[model samples]
Target: MRCFIFVVFLSSVAAWSEPFRPWLIAAYGDTTNQTDRYQMGNDNTVIDIYTNLMWESGFLNVSTINLANKNCVSLFKNGYSDWRVPTVHEIQSLLDYVNAPGINEDYFTSLPSNESVLVTSSSSLQPTDLVLVVQQQTRSISSQYPPDMNVRCVRGPQRTAPLDRYTKFQYADKNFVKDQATGIGWMTESSAIWFCDQAVDLSQVWTPTIKALFSLFNQSNSPLIDEAVFSLPSMLYLGSSTPVAGENGYLWAIDGSTGLFQTVPLLGPAMAYCATVQLD
Candidate 1:
């Protein structure tokens, strides 16, 4: 009996030690110069790990979106000639705000210190000649009419798990939904009454609502559910990177604005999307 129990314990330990998900791996096709993260490939190309996308590190002064698209196709890199603009989501994933260049510095080595704006694959929200401009370092997604933003070319299929942004589930007789890609759990029926245009202070904006909601969730006397505290999700988590509008649309974000990020249609269109890290 003891021997049987010991073998079971070992198996459980091994299972627990296994990796939960695959992390970014740097390789020759995705890296160069024998360096990690990303390295400059031959020519002006750089291989990034996360999206498996080849990027042109060159910054250009293009006149319009049409010209930018043409510029990418005209250039050849590393014996290949397939290049195009990166999507808003792709650009968002590349941004590492903690890092110096706000991207992989090894690959994109010489980015300017001053604000560098880049054009995305998306068109204007209001359907003008304007296009979305992604600020290189910070989380700013503004629009520029006449399309004056710089262009960065990317070529590769986007990799993401085949799951809904929010997968609804039931636990302890209460409703919960988890963001499949990010593993953030949210209470389905709970939300706050926050308007987008309302100017809010940094410390107090999302705090009181979060604490109140968490307290409410904890009040449910269910033995199966514990640690029900919830917090607000970052703009990135709530589909801020997505360029197009859909049924599962925008949520109030802590990023993307100078002071109190505002959404369109005042408060009517804006929705609350509170999320919390799921504990095992």
Candidate 2:
């Protein structure tokens, strides 16, 4: 079993003031358009060229984590036997931000229905109390295990991009300040508007264009920008100033835990920032 030291309950999404949509922050520059990184594979699987991860749409029909891991170990598929349960982060990468139910349907031949929740190999701070979850567009932390939770397997090394790909920014520790670094508090469009008007160097940090915001997670296969600098438990939802293409009165926010990106009301909460100086 994967033992982790961080545990967050479902209530974490709700806010003391307002629900701040979660998003991961990064320090680096430039983002490559991730349009063509996949190819179809046999045995109802899809291969991510960049991550070199072969995802099997099946090996499905397992309920518990133990059963899922056992199946992966004993089973072989598509001429490969190195399969294992995927981490929540790897599953998060498969989410399709532009599509509903948050997955790329064109590549994978099968997936759990929208109602079905997918479990990962990761453990919560309290392993028995929680586990990492992925379904549709959002990745979440859940205490209750659905009766028929689904499990999928992946094979190959965890691909990691070099640090040079993202824009570099510094942040105060998530301790005294909860604003941008931890994504724990409310920050709305008005705040971004205020920053833009003030002419701050990193003013665009909060309300950056879609490309700049997505660049944070798009640059890495793992959910985090830098594990050395941040802790998984400290991150929360982030709201971006970017507007959804067809949806009026809606802006995009990313769930830092699940890597889900979807629209929320413009006045709703979101926190995101990257800077050189400490956040006061």
What lDDT tens digits, residue by residue, belong to model 1 across residues 1-280?
1100000000001111223332232220111233444556888787765336677776566666666667666657787666655555445445553344555655664445455555443321111222455555443454433234466666654324433445667644546666454344555532433521132421212212211121121111332112233333333122111112222433223221221123332223334433343111
lDDT of 2 at 61: 66
Counting only residues 3 or more apart in sequence or on different chains, how many pairs clash (N, Cα, C under 3 Å) in candidate 2? 17
Candidate 2 TM-score to native = 0.54
What is the number of backbone collisions in each predicted candidate, taken in the order shown? 0, 17
The 10 consecutive residues of candidate 1 with the worst lDDT sum are 3-12
Error of 1 at 212 (Å): 24
Q: Name the regions of candidate 2 deviating beyond 4 angstroms.
A: 1-35, 110-114, 122-130, 137-144, 159-237, 240-264, 274-280
Q: How far is candidate 2 from the true structure (C-alpha RMSD, Å)?
A: 12.0
What is candidate 2's lDDT per residue for 1-280, written digit by digit as tens? 3212111111111112222222232211112124676677877777775445678864366656667767666657787766766654455456544455445566653343444445543321111223644444332323334556556677655333333323333432222123332232222222332253244454433345332344344212454344433333333656555555457777666666655565667665555533222211
Best by TM-score: 2
* Candidate maximizing lDDT: 2
Provide the overall lDDT of each model, using Cα atoms, as 2-decimal numbers. Answer: 0.40, 0.45
